[model samples]
Target: MASAMNSLIPAFTFILALVTRMEKLDLKVQSSQAKSIGTILSITGAYIVVFYQGPPILFSRPLPNLHSFSVSLQSNWIVGGFLLATSSFLISLLYIVQTWIIKDYPAEMVVTLFGCIFVTILSAIVALIVERDPNAWTLKPDVELITIVYSAVFMVSIRSVIYAWVCRIKGPVFVSTFRPLGMAFAVFMGVTFLKDTLHIGSVIGAVTIALGLYAVMWGKANEVQIIEENVISRVDSSSDKVPLLQNKSMEV
Candidate 1:
């Protein structure tokens, strides 16, 4: 479910960018048409993953046999799906906010540091509210402690810095185009490490997401090429006119 939601991040980001006027859409342009179609496909694939878990194609162990639609309707699963979707949207929003900040501040490390600081504070507050037992706060010198330190240093801190720098260079929509890749990684890790069941729906959805990602990336590349070409043409025209103006000045 979380992986499915991850696939929707790019679609959400594109929609938000369009709303904010950070992204433009022209139906007449092939690049824009490709982007729009890709967004639709990405979103459609996500929903299919969430709601239609077809038959299990591969499973390490025998699991409960229930229809895909029934599984989706479970109250707990519904809540989890909602939360995952909300998280994906928030992640996209974070990308947009980071892009906006980086444009003005132009300091990736500083922005990452402040973002981590605020996140830590908010997490502490949430932890305090949710975990009433004092024993939960104890940090033992074990693998759990090591994992926490590793995540804090590498996953949160280092990842944030890299993402901020990328967001500064590329727009938020560009950064979001990679979200579908995480879904692939997550599926591989879960199936390999946790012996999770792999279903036909998931496989189909993942492939659809990949296709959509490719289309969107191709469109973006074309757009960049067009922009560069326009810039070069303008410069050439300006230079050509400069010689004509010089000749006119010599005649005068």
Candidate 2:
């Protein structure tokens, strides 16, 4: 049931992106720029998925069975959840800073510095919490917590900033196409790092996701091209009218 729920998340995200006009559906008018952005996003998503999911399959000996969900969280799950939540919030706050600070500073430098600061703060907080409540904390180090923090700090923060910068230079569609890529990366990372084995159903779902992403990009590219052509044609017609008007005024 958890796996099924997880599998549907990507589809949900894709649907949301489409509804928000963050992606396209046509292919004939797809832009090379969108394709470029999409490729990176896809790769990133793939890597993330593989990392997160692959472990269970690869290390099946230690992992819970697919049908099992009875494992108690105990203190470890609480500590880990707290860490994950805190890290996510910190990363989001940093992302806001990046959105505003990039206007005045080099985005890459700002993001990198913020990332370092976040790591330091996160470490300090974890240490303090553990020190204060040693007995209350989990005995095991939370790998999930660590992974979430890393993903938010590096993947979410850096990628979002890069996408924003790219959109400013190129266009929105170019950056929007990356949504699919991010999904792909998540899937890939889950499988690879977590040792999650992909069944035929998962593979089929992934392929469908790929196709949907392509459709969205293609539609966006067509829309952009059509708008550009219309603007140019209007400008040309206006320019020709101006010359004609000047000639008529001179004769009068």
Candidate 3:
């Protein structure tokens, strides 16, 4: 499951970049080079996660041990893959829902109240249904609960509201660059909080991913420049033609 999440993180990032229009590698851009770079980055990230992270976890201690190949095939990988896929689907759905709902509403209020209400209800339902000990839900210290609440509020509510307003004012390239910044944050957090040993392969992988993201952004900026240049060129040509027409009219 952890390995699956590692793969999904990059996939989610790519999806978010497209949906937010931060990078354009589509047919309208007519740039095969841009599309190829995006594909390479995505595939490389997926391959890294699958080869480096997936196998270790799949064969490790936490997962249930199956005595036979048939049992392992039936019980473990298939179910784990399905859950990971479902998680990706749900994250996409959440983004879509939040985008739609906040389109007409004040982003802050919409994110805060709506998110809080939904999470509270959902958590309560889950606690009732699945928590073997109902009191386990209430056993957390007030400080811990407050911290969780604040983090949730900030992540889903405050940050999202800010992002929407930022998107409106700054445009896509600015927003997209923050993704690499986020990857940097992940590296920092892993080193600090988790005390995870930084491997050479990990550093190389991060650098590769960062470079790929930058290439996609570079392509977008190039496309934008081309569009502006074309518009300016047409305007200049039209202006020059008008003066020639005026000169001919005077001669006539």
Candidate 4:
């Protein structure tokens, strides 16, 4: 469910980019229309994933203990969904801010470092407040420790730097367009490692999100191509004017 919400980041980023005037939208343009449709598809897919959980498809054998937590998941579904949506919104906002910073500073690593530091501090504060059990905070020499180290290094550190660099080069909307790609990995991992039931709605939602992402990518690519062509045309026209101006000055 969280992953489903996360897939909406591209749409959120697109809207934010538009709001910030970093992106232009003309409904008469095919590319802009594609982008708008893509955003709507992504949103529709997310809602389907949240509201409609069709019959579970057999993916893998569930662990014997799987049923124990099903009730808890159902109970907290609304709250978790709300939090996930909020997190997605905040992530989109962060991408916009990161792009703004990178535009001026052009420092990916430095931006990522500061971002990770503040995020860590904020996470720690939240953890301390929510986690009442001291044992939950303790890191043991086991899978938990390994997971923490891996997430800290790869997910937080490396990924942050990569995202920052990409944002600097391609802009945040372009960077965020890949968010739906993670849905495939999330579904695979959940079914394989977690032995979770695969729902038909989830599969449909994931496919819909992927299609929307592709549409958005195609639209963005076309827009870039058009902009480049316009730039080249302007340069050619300006160069032609340059010779005329020079000839006029020489005659004078």
Candidate 5:
């Protein structure tokens, strides 16, 4: 259930990209084969990471699953699934809008600053609505507090800016392509810090993510090469025309 819900983000993002025509797949017909393979591999890897849990190979045995969805319990799952679907669509729409905005504004810091502010405002309103206990607002300078601060300031702030810049430069397709690798990194962190079991699926998923990343990188390299070649050819042809134009003018 979690796998199906989580995969919606990338799936929706890809569909939206197609609809927006942000990255024209037809232009790269030869490279599309590799990119299609990468997309499949990455999505599969992400699914494996989300859903697969096998016997532990590293550390102790894996943590027991507590929140398993059953056929008997369908209402909460339905609600949750609806929320996930709505969030996924909004996120994809946000990506398209952000890319368009950054193209016009082109200031990474300003965009990120406004984005963080808007997120904070929305989050605060939600907290005010749901968080009735005033005690929950109090912060002690503990590990949790430090972690929150670091995540907000260093991780989110930095990442949002970088992502916006990349979107402006390369379009949203390139940004969405790395979505699967996030799961691989989470697996690694779980093993290192949480003493979570490493399973066969995790190993295979990580390897697949690597292959997918490589394929995407290769396709981008080819795309860049094509762009550069076209630019140089245009420059050379234009340069050749200059002398002829000058000679004809002199003859006239």
Candidate 6:
């Protein structure tokens, strides 16, 4: 699951760029080349960080016995990877469509609220079919209740609305570029809370990802500055040309 996500950062980024036409891969358009390079760097960095689990740069967590885990779940890596990849592709497509919708509708709250409701219903139906055990459906009002409420309110409702609004403003490509950071954050939390191992490869990957992040940020800043400069230049040119218009006008 983690590896699939790391590999898909650039995939999602490039796909969103293509969808929005920020990148054409044309030699004449330097913007496309720069974007491509940034995407490559970001993707490579993500892969390195995720795939390279070298000797621990810090304390290593003891590996749990494989026997303790469910064999069926443990053996389903191939299926799990495929599902994650598929979901990633769908999410990439989703952002593109969502951006287009926001332009027309301009109401992110409607989308976020209804979207949550719709997904909850559909997911519930699917979950019912998949889990079969009624006992598993039973919930206790302990930590689980708190977790459910927090996740529903903060993660789903709040985060989705913010994401939708940002998607409208920044477009999906900008949002997709930052996805690799999620992996880094997950690793950090795992190490801190779960006493997970700190691999040397993970350190290198993290550093590479940081560099890639800087590169992306620099590229985006330059693009924004150039856009602002172009707008100012256009305004100035239009103002100058306005004076060239003939003052003489016949009665009409």
Backbone clashes for every candidate come to: 0, 48, 0, 0, 0, 1
- Report every candidate's CA lDDT: 0.82, 0.52, 0.56, 0.82, 0.78, 0.73
Every candidate's CA RMSD: 4.5, 9.2, 7.8, 3.1, 3.6, 3.3
Identify the leading candidate in terms of TM-score.
Answer: 5
Better of 3 and 4 by lDDT: 4
Model 4: what TM-score?
0.83
lDDT of 5 by residue, 117-217 (tens): 99999999999999999999999999989999999987889999988998898777677777778788888998887667788888888888778767766
Model 3, range 1-252, lDDT digits (tens) per residue? 544344454346446656765445466564436644654564464445334532121111322343335433445777777887777656544544455455556465656576768787998888788878856767476888988788877876777667556444433333433443454457556656655445444455466666666665676567767888999999988877657778899999
Q: Would you estimate the TM-scores of all the predictions?
A: 0.82, 0.45, 0.60, 0.83, 0.86, 0.83
Which regions of candidate 1 fall more than 4 Å away from where they truly are? 1-7, 62-86, 243-252
Q: Candidate 2, after superposition: displacement of residue 47 in Å?
A: 18
lDDT per residue for candidate 6 within 25-86, as digits (tens), equals 45355454565566676677678776678887779565567348754544677787888887
User: Can you tell me which runs of candidate 4 are displaced by over 4 Å?
Assistant: 1-8, 55-59, 69-84, 128-137, 243-245, 248-252
lDDT of 2 by residue, 81-153 (tens): 5565455344333334443455456556556566658776998798887788666455345886688778877
For model 1, residues 36-139, the per-residue Cα lDDT tens digits are 87777777666666677799988866334533344344368878889998998999999988899999999999999999999999999999999999998899
lDDT tens digits, residue span 1-252, model 4: 776688778778988999998888999998888777777776666656667779988667778776675443346778888999899999999999999999899988899889888988999999999999998877789998999899999998999999999888778887887776666557768888888878998788778877777777788888989999999999989877657778899999
lDDT of 5 at 194: 67
